[model samples]
Target: MQCSFRQLKEKSLSTEVTQMQWNPKMDLLALANTQGEVWLHRLNWQRVWTLSPPTGTTEGQGVTGLAWRPDGQVLGVGYQNGQVVLCDVEKAEVLHTSTLSHPVSCMTWQEAEDKHRVTSAPVHVDQSSSPVSSQATPQDTAADFLPRLTPLPKGYSATDKANSEEEIVEDNKRLSSQTRLNILVVGDEAGSIYLLAYGLFSMGQLAPEEHPQAKGGRLLSVTLSSDLQCLSAVVQHQASADTSQPEHTICLTTYNTSLLATRSQELATLAMKYGQVATILGYMENTLRSMSEAWEDILLEMDNKLAKFAETIDNKDPDWQVSDEFLQLLMWGKASPELQSFLLNTLTEKGLKKLGLSIDNSYSNIEKLVLNHLQRAGQALLFHLSELKGLSLWYDKYGMLGLNTQAVQEAWSCAGSFMLKTNELLQ
Candidate 1:
C-alpha cells in the first residue's frame, strides 16, 4: 500500500532540532535543539517561548529528550548534562528540577484515566485513606476540608502570558488537585531509570544493571505501554569487548507493570491526598516564614531598648538582686533610686506602655497565623499522610510502588509534632 503525505507547515530555525514531541492533548509542539534550548510552538509553527539551558552549562551539552506531561501542561526537558527540568508550558517557567548520576537518554510521561469522571461514591476526598487498612472503595477520593490557599504572587506575570491565563488555570485545575495518576519516566545511559509521581515527587529508580537483561549494556530509550501494563527499554550491548573498538548490539527488554494498571484508581486517589499534603505544607511554610520576618523587625526594636538597659545595669549590679528589687517595687509602689531612675527617666510610663503594646500586637499576630493557618495546615497535612500510609498497609499491592510504610508513618508523626509545636509557640 502506498500513501501520499503533504507537509502543512514548516519553519526554519537557526538551531538544529535534535528531538521533538507533539503534545498529546493539544496542538502545541515541544522541540529540543542542539543548543540545549527547548522551544514551544503553536499548530501553525508560530514560536511560543524558548527555554535556555541552565547557567554555566557548556555549549556542547545539548538537550537529550523532551516529554510533555500527560495533560500537555508541563514539559519535561532532559539534557546531556544529567539534569531534567519540568517547565510550565505557558511561559517556559520551571516547576521542578532533578539531577541524575548519568546523562539522560530518553523520557516518557503517562497518566492513568481521570478519577473525577469515575462514578464512585464520594468518600472524604480530603483524607482518602488510612493505615488502619480498609480496601479502597469506589468512593475513595480527596475530601479536602482545608481552606483554599491564597495563590502566592507568581514570578512570571508578563503581559505576553496573559493570553494563556485561562489555559494555565485549566491546567492547574487539573494538576493542583491530582485528579489523574501520572508518572514521568527518565532513562539514563548508565542503565538506570528514574520515576517521578505527578512529575514532582520521586517515586523510585530502576537499576537495570542489577538485572540479567542489562548484562553490560547501556540504556538507549524507555517507554511505558498505553495501558500501563508493561515498560519497554532498549539497550545497547557491546558485541565485541574491545575497549578501543567495540561492536554494539541493540536489544529490547520488558518488565511487568500490571500493578500500575490494576491499582490505577486507588493510586490516583492516593496521589490526590498527597497533593493535598503538599499544598498544606506549602501554605504552612509561607505563613510561618511571614510570621518569622515580622518578628525579626520586632526583635531589632526590643534589642535596641534592651541594650540601653543592659548598659545602665552593668555598673550597678555587682551583688544586688534586681529580681527582688522589682518584686519590692511591684508590692510597695516605690523603687530604689537606681531602679526608679531607669524606669521613670529612661523609660517613661507612656513609652513603656507603648513598647508592651507593640510586643503584644506582634504576639497576637503570631497566634493568629499559628492557630488559624499553620496549625490547621499541619492537621490537614496529617490527614492526607495518614491516608497515604493506609495505602502502604496493602503490602501486596503497594510494595512494588516503593512506598515504605515506616516512612509514611514517620511523615505522619512529624506532622503531628509540627501541630504540637505550633500550639506551644502560641502559648
Candidate 2:
C-alpha cells in the first residue's frame, strides 16, 4: 500500500502532543498528550481507548512517549516524570506501570533469526567412477557436506525407521541450503541499538542424526563466526539547522563498542543465553534510580529557592519587593516544617491568616495537602516499589536470588519498608 498521512482530528483536546505511534499492523494509532492522557484510535480515525493518569500525579508530570510491541499486543506509554504505563491492547486494561529517572524518550523492539540448523557429520563419500573429476555439481557439493546415514537397527519400529530416513535427507538438503533473512533491529535514546534473534536451539535437541561420529558432534556450531547472528550500534551527530540543508540527513557517529558493531549477531545469541536478562535488569534498576534522583532534585531545588526567598525577604530593605518567582517556588511540595514555622513567625496573625500560611492554625490544612502531594510522590514511588517487590517475589519463587544476593535483599528490605511507610503516611 502507498504511504499516506491523514488528520483524524483537527485539534487534540490536550494542547501538547509529545509522541505518536502506529501499531505493527497499522490498524491502530496511539497519541500521548502532555496532560498525562493517552488516546488510542482506530486506523480510520475512530476514538477507541483513552488511558488516564493514575490518580494523584503531581502538577508537572505528563505523558511523553508511546510504543507498541512487535505483535501489537501491548502499548507502553511514557511520562515526563519518567513513568511507564503498559496497557493490554485487546482488554484495554493497564497491566504494568514503571518509573525511570530520566524520561523514557523512546522504545523499540528487536527480533532475531533462528540460527539452529539440522546438521549431519559428513563422511567422505567414495566416488570410484570418475574420481578425478575437477568440477563439482550441486548434488556433489551437498553430498560432501551430508552425513553418512546409518541404517535402522533390527529392533527399530517401522515408524521410527521411516522418520529417521526422512530426517537424514532433510539434513542433507539443508547442508547446501541458501541463506535466509530473519532479523529485527531496535534502537533506544541511550545512544544504542541492538539486533536480536529468536528460535535458536541445538540440533541434538531436534530430529536425530545418522552419522557414526554424531555422538560427539554438535548439531549446531557454537562458533559465532560461521553460526550465530551479528549486531551493530551506530551513533548519530545532531547538527543545527543553520549549518545543514533543509533536506533530512543523518550524520553517523563513530561506534565506541566494536564488539557490538562487528559481532552483533553473535551478541544477540549470547544475550538470550545469559546476557540479555542482566542487561534488562540493569536497565530497569538504572532507570528507577534516575527517576528517584529527578524527584529528589526537584524537591531540593524548590527547597533552596524557598531558603533564598526567606533570607532575602528578611534581610532586604523594608520597601524592597519579593519576586513572583520566589513565591512560586515556595508553593511547591510538602511545605518544609521549618519553613512553615518561619512563615508563621514572619507574618502577623492576620497576615498569616490571609496568606493561609499559619503553622498553628493551618495544621489540619497542611496535613491534608501533605497527604495529597505525598500521595502524588507515592504514585511514582509505588511504581518502583512494586516492581522491586515483584522482582523479589520472582527471585524467591524461582530461587535465583543467589546471583545478586546482597543487592536483591537490600532492594527487598528497602522497598518493603518504603511501601509500608507510604501506606501508613497516606492513611
Candidate 3:
C-alpha cells in the first residue's frame, strides 16, 4: 500500500505539538501541545474543537500523552501533572478524570479478541496428527478439539472452580468481531504502569490497576498485543554519575488481561447496578436543591425591593398600588397556576407509559449486567485456583532441576494466602 503525508502550517496550532494520535476507526487526529491544550483535527487538516484542561492548579501543566478509545467516541489526554482526562470530542465536554502519582509519559489503547471464536475454534495443524508434514490440507485444518471451557459439574473442587473462573475472565476480555472492550494502558515517569477499565472511566469512575515497577526511567511509549495478554514499554533511563550519555531500555511485561478485565468488568457491572439508584435520587435531589436556592434568591431580592417600595410610599409615590399587588402575588406563591395545570395535563396515558418503559429498560439493563458479572466472577475464581495448582506443579519440577526453590516456595505461599483471603471475602 502506498501512503502520503501532509504537513500542517504553523498557523494551524498556537504552540508546538507534544503528542498526537490518529483515531483507530476514524479520519480524525487528536493533538496535544506543550501549553496543555488539546485539539481535534480532520485528516484534511481542518480544525475541529479545542479543549483546555479543567481550571485549577494543574491548568499550567503541559500535555504529555494522547490516546483515542477504539470506537473513536472519546479522547484520553494525559498531562504533566499526572492527570488523565477523557473528553467527548464532539460535545467538547469532560467525561472523566483520573490522577496518577507521577507525570504521564505514554499511553496506549487496545481491544481484546472475540471470546466465542477464541474458545470454540479448532486447533490448526500441518497435517492430521503427522509428526513431520510440510503442507496441511483443508481437511486436516478442519480437525477440532473440545471447546476451551466446559460447564462445571456440581461439587467441583476449589482448584477447579478457580481455574474455570480464570478462563472465563480471560475469555470475557476478548473482543468480538463487532464489539470492543476498550482498555487504556498508561505509563509514567516514575516507572509505574496503570491499566484503566475504559468502560468505567467513561462512566466517570477511575478503575485502575498498577503493574510491577520498571527500572528507573522515563517511559517513552507503551504498546499492547491484540490479544491483550502482553504489554511492551520503551523507557529512557538517565545516565549514571560515571556516564556521560543517557541509555534507553526496552521493557516487556506479560499479564493475564483476563484477570484485570475481570476486576474491571466487576467494577463496571457493580457501578451500573448501583448507579441507577444513585441517578434517580441525584436527579430529584438536585432539582429540589436548585428550586430551594432559586426561592431563596427570589425572597432576598423581593425583600430589598419591598424595603425600597416602603421608602417610596413614605415619599408619597402613586406607583405603590402596582408594587403592592406584585408583592401580594409573590407572597401568596400562587403565580402562574395555569402553567402548572398545563404541565400536569400534558402527562397523558401514552406519555406515562413511555416513561415507565424507559425506567423498566434501565432496570433491565442493570439486571443483565449484574447477572453477567456474577457468572463471570464464579468462572474467574475457578480459573484462578486452577492456575495456583499448576504453579505448585511447576515448583515441584523446578525443585527436581536443582534450582533454588525457597523464593518460589515463598511466592507460592503468598499466592495461596491471597487466594484464601479472596475466598474468605467471597464467603
Candidate 4:
C-alpha cells in the first residue's frame, strides 16, 4: 500500500521539471519547467519520444501547474504570469490562454454542476404506508413544511448579528449537473487551490459564457503540507442517470506522487435522489466490492508486469522483486465473525478436503492402517484398564469396537495372536 516514487528517467530539460501532466487517454506526459519551456514526452520503456520546444526563450513564465484535458487533445498549463494556457499536445500549439485573479496556484475541472431546479416528475407516496399524515387527515398545508425563521429579537446585539452572518456561510458547495468538463486544478506556492472548468468542447458546443477560460471555477484553500509540495482535490464523477452515455471518472495524481483524487461525488448524490437510505447503502456496498476487486486485480496483473520488468533489470532491484510486504497485503486477513462461524460449523468437511482425505471412509481407513502398521511392527498394544475385573460397562466408552465384554476380549485375543506371528517373522 505504501510506495515511493522511483525515478524512471531524468531528461535535462533546459530547466527542472516544474509541472507534468499525464494525458487522460494516452501515455503522453507534458512537462513544463522554470525556463518557460514546455516539452511533450511519450512514455514507454523501450522507446521514449520527446518533443522539445520550438525555440528556447525565457518569456519570464515559470510553469507552476500542468493538466491534460479529459479527451487528451489539449493540455492546461498554469504559469507564474497568473495565466492559464490550453496547449494542443499533438501539434504542439497553444490553443487558448487567459489570465486569472491571483498567480495560478492549482487548477482543476469543476466535476459537479449546480442543479438549482428539479426536472424529473415527482412520485407521490401512498398515504396509508407513508410516514407523512394521511390525505384524509386535515393538517397544515405543505407550506408549513418549508423552512421558516422566527423574527429577530428586539435590539439584537452586534455579536448576535455577526454570529448569524457566519452561520450562513456556504463552503465550496456545488450543484449537480450532467455535463462533463475536464477538471484542470492548480495549486500555487501560496497554498491556494484554483479549479478551472476547461476543455469546453467536451460538454458539446458551448456559449461564450461556458468557455473554459471565461467560466473559471471556485477557489478554496485546501489542506497542504508546510512546504506546499502537493495538493489534491476530490471531484464529482459524471452523471449516469441518462442511459444514452456512460459516465466517466478521472483520477489525478501529482508529480511527487503524494496525492490522488477522484471525481465521483455527483454519482453518489444522484443515487440518493430516488431513495436516499436504500441507495446510499447499496452505493457503499458496491464501492467496497469495487475497491476489493480493484486491489486484487492489481496484484494479479502485477505478477506478469513484475516478471517482465524483472527480466530486464538486476534481480536485486527492490522494486522489481515482489516483496514480502506486498505478498502479505495480497493474502486474506482475519475472517469476519459470520464467516468464521460458517467455517467452524463445517470444519470436518473443509479440513478433510484441504488435507486431501475423504470425509466418510478415507479418514477411518487411514486411522485403521496406522493401527495395523503399529501391530505388525511388533509394538505392544497395551490397554491401561482399572484393576476391577469384569468391567464390561467400560468397554463401550473406550470405543473398543464392541459393547459386550466377550466381543471386546475376543478382538484383543485375535490381535494378540496376530502380533505373535508378526514377531516370529521378524525373528
Candidate 5:
C-alpha cells in the first residue's frame, strides 16, 4: 500500500534557521538560528520559550547542533565552542552542561529497542555476562540499598533565589534516567564522537584516530545504529590536489563497533546506574552550596551583634583570640562590661533572645538539610558509582565505556570522606 502525504500548516520563519528538530513525543518543534538562538514552539506556531547564547560566548561560537531527549523533556543544544547545555523544555532552564575539547558539529539522540533483553542494571562486582544480580534497576530506586533522595527544603537555588517562585525552575525537573535506554551521541569537528547516556553519562568516545580522514575535515553528521552495531559519520574537506576548481572531498565512513552489539544490554543497564549517580550528585552539590550560604548568612548577621568584640581581638593579636567576655556571660550568667555594651548596656533582652533564636533555627535547618538530603544523596552516588567501578573489573566486557577505575575509586573515597567530615562538623 502506498502512503499519502498531506500538507500541514505552513508558517514562514523570520530568520535563517541553521538546524531544526521536532519533538517525537509532542507537537513542539525545536529550532536554532544563525544568531545562535534556540526556540521552542508548539504546533500552532506559538513560541513556548527562547534560549539566548550564554553570556560571554565568543563571536562565531554560534549553535552547531540541536537534539531533543527521547522523552522530549530536555533539549541538548551544542555550540561551536565545544559546549553543550541541556535545557528544560518548559522554561529553557539550563539543567546541566558539558564540554568537549573540539567544536561540536552534530548530535543525535538514539533510543534502544528491547530486543527481548532483560530490563535491569548490572549491579554485582563479580564476573558475569548479564545483569547477574537481583537488585532493582531504577538502579535501586527499587533496590533494598541506596536510599532515595528527598528534595531539599526550600529547594535552595543560589542563582534563582532572588526570583519569584513562578520564575524559579523546579529541582525535580532536572535530568534523570528513563525506562528505556536512550543515548545522546555528539560529534565534533576533530573527528570524535561522544556517546552520552541521559545527556549526562560519558559512556564512551570514538577518537580522531578512528577516522583519519575526518581529522581535518568538517563532520557533517554522526549516528549510532539502532541495533547498536555500527557507528557512522559523513565528512567533507577541500581536495588540494584539484585546486583549480576548488574541489571538495566528501567521505562517508562507518566503523564496526563490536562492543555496541556484544554489550548492548550491559550498556543499556549501566546507563541507568550512571544516570542515578548523576542526578544524586547534582542534588548533593546543591545541598552543599545551600549549606555554605546558610553559614554565610549566620556569620553576616552575627557581625552586626559582635563586630566590636571581633575588632578588639583582631587588634590585640593577628590570630583572633576570643576574650572571656562571651565565656563569662555564658558560664556565670553575668555579662562583662564590653559584653553588656554589646547587649545594649542594659536590657535589649527581647532583641537578644530573638536574634539568638533566629541563629539557632538557621543552624537547625542547615543541620537537618544535611542529615536528610545531602547525606542520602552522597551515599547514593557512592553506592552507584562503586557499581560502575565494579563493571571495570571485567574490562573485556565493559571496556568500551572507558570507565576509569582509579577515578571512580577516588570519587567513592571522596564521597565517603565528605560524609565523615560533615558528621564531624555537625557533632
Candidate 6:
C-alpha cells in the first residue's frame, strides 16, 4: 500500500533551525535554532515554551544537539561549549546541567534495559510542529549526522509497568531502577562518546577499538538501536590531502546491556562510599578549627593575666621601678643580659613567688591546649577507624560481584595499626 501525505500548516521562525526532536508520547515538538534558543511547539503549531541559552554563552555558540527524555517531561540540549542542560518541559525550568571537556556534537537519550530483546508498537506523533512541510517527500536515506527515532521494544513502556497511580508513585521514587535510568549518550568534537547515567549522576567515556581512518573527526550524530544493543555514529573529518572537501564516516559500536547495568550499580555504590568519606573529613576539619580557636583563647588569657600582674606590681611598689621591668622581662624575655643578671641577683622572695605563680598559670593553659588537641585528634582517629570498618564490610559484600576489594582490606589494616599506635601515645 502506498502512503499519501498532505500539507497541514506552516509557521516561520526568526533563526535557522539547528536541530529538532518530536516527543515520543506527546504532540510536542522541540526545536533549536542558531541563537541557542529552544522552542516547544504543539501539534496545532502553537508555541508552548521557549528556553534561552544559559547566561555567559555567546550567541554564535548555539545548540548543537537535542534529545527528549522517554517520559517527554525533560529536554536535553547540547551546546557548542560542551554544556548539556536538562530542561523540565512542563514547568519551563532547568532541572539539571552538566559540562564536558569538548564541544558537544550530538546527544541521544535512551531508556535502560536488560540484555534480552523486546519489541513495541511504533509511536506516531503529529508532524505539524515540524519546521518542514508535512507534504514533503520522504528521503531514501537520512542525513549521516542526524539522529532518527526508533520504536522502543515491547514490555519496556513505563505505562505498561505501572498500571496504578500508587505504583507510579513508587516507581518515581526509585530513580535508580533500570526502568528509570535514563542514559544520555553524548558524542563530542574530539571523536569521543560519553555515557552518562542521569539517574545515578555518573558519567564515563566510551572508548571504542581504534580505527586508523577515524582517528581525528568531529562526531556529527549518534543514534541507538531500538533494543539499545547497538550505537551508531556519524563522524566528519577533513582529509590531509583534500582540505576543501570533508570526509564522513559511520562507526557502529555494540554493547551488552547487562554490563552497563552492573557498571551503573558500581558507580552508585562508589559515589555513596565517597560521600561517607567526605562527611568524616568534614568532621575532622571542624574539630581542627575548634582546637585552633581554643589555642587562640589561651593566648589571649595569658596576655590579660600578665598585664594585670604588671599593673598590680607597679601599684603596690611605686618606688620600685625594677618590679615592672622584672615582670616585663619574665613575660616577654626583653630584658638586657646585664639587667637580667642584676635582677636575678637582687630578686626578693616575695617577687619570685609572684612570678612563679604567674608562670604556673600560663603553663597550665598551655598544657590544657595540648590535651585538647590530643583528645580531638584521638576522636577523629576513632571515627576514621569506624568508617574503615564499614568500608571493609562494603568490600566484602561487593567482592562477590567481581570488584577488587584488596585496597579496602589494606586500608582497614592500616587504620587498625594507626589506632594501636594512637593508643600507645595516649598511654
In candidate 5, stretches whose alpha carbon ends up further than 4 angstroms from where it belongs are: 1-15, 56-61, 116-120, 124-143, 155-177, 305-340, 344-347, 399-401
| Model 6 stretches astray by more than 4 angstroms | 1-3, 114-178, 207-213, 225-229, 242-258, 261-427
Model 2 TM-score, 2 decimals: 0.33
Model 3: per-residue lDDT, tens digit, 327-369?
Answer: 4655786534432343256445675465445444433433332
lDDT of each: 0.68, 0.41, 0.51, 0.39, 0.72, 0.55
**Reference-based lDDT, residue 227, model 3:** 55
Reference-based lDDT, residue 55, model 1: 83
lDDT of 2 by residue, 343-415 (tens): 5565447754544432322333233323433333333333333333343344432124222445546754664
- Candidate 5 per-residue lDDT, tens place, 121-183, comes to 655334442332223332333357755565555643232243334431123435333556667
Stretch of 10 with least lDDT, candidate 3: 137-146
Question: What's the true lDDT of residue 272 in model 5?
Answer: 60
Q: What is the lDDT of residue 409 in candidate 6?
A: 60
TM-scores for all predictions: 0.69, 0.33, 0.50, 0.29, 0.79, 0.49
**Candidate 4: tens digits of C-alpha lDDT, residues 256-293:** 31211221222122221212212222333333343344
Query: Order of candidates by lDDT, top first?
Result: 5, 1, 6, 3, 2, 4
| Winning model by TM-score | 5
Which residue runs of candidate 3 sit more than 4 Å off their true CA positions? 1-12, 58-60, 116-179, 199-215, 243-250, 256-258, 261-292, 306-427
lDDT of 1 by residue, 1-427 (tens): 2457766776788989999999988989888888788888889888899998888866537899889887788899888878888888877777667889888888989775443132222243334563212343345443445443333322211222333333321123235534456788888878887877676666667896556676667878788876678888888888765566558878898988876677665555555555455556656777778688657645655655545555666556576544555557658998778777877788888878876776677666666666655766676677678767777776765655666899999988888887788778877
